[model samples]
Target: MTNDELQQLAAGLANCGKALLRMADVLMEKKEDAPAAAEQKEPEKKLTLEDVRRVAADKARQGHMEEVRQLIQKFGADKLSGVDAARYPAMMKELEAMGNDE
Candidate 1:
């Protein structure tokens, strides 16, 4: 092949390499973002009084009754039932964490 033809072919190949690299970068970015997008799309499970009660019961059974009562009182409730429904998620989180402390 002529020198000029070979140079032109080299430049074309380099351009194609750059294009491929850009495509790879885009695909990688999308892959990295996929999990975050999925997490954002997935709705948080709604916490219920019963769910909180179940966890609290487990903690109590494990002999954390006093700790459970303090956690409930921290939310300004004397008992689990007295705590507002809106606070169930936070209450459950604390109850679950109580077991992890061990």
Candidate 2:
């Protein structure tokens, strides 16, 4: 409403803008230096299902029979009634097909 009041308001706004610009400059500087300032890191190696299968097969072929048995016990078998009698051969066939595919 008054010239002095408007000038005071403008001065306040200018101070806020300067503060925001300084904060932005500091943030930009940190971002620019972040990668080099931190460790040059290696990308992590991810183990896939195929990697696991290959490792298990290798271990099995090397006579890690108990390891193979444990893996089969852990993740291979479907938990169902009469699974051993009902699905064992089919499972064997599926495994054989998988081996053939490989």
For model 1 the local lDDT of residue 42 reads: 65
lDDT against the true structure, each candidate: 0.90, 0.60
Top-TM-score structure, candidate number: 1
Q: How many backbone clashes does candidate 1 have?
A: 0
Clashing pairs in 2: none
lDDT of 1 by residue, 1-102 (tens): 999999999999999999999999999999999998888766778988888999898889999999999999999999889999988888787888896856
Query: Which parts of model 1 have CA positions greater than 4 angstroms off?
Result: 1-39
lDDT of 2: 0.60
Which ten contiguous residues of candidate 2 have the minimum total lDDT? Answer: 78-87
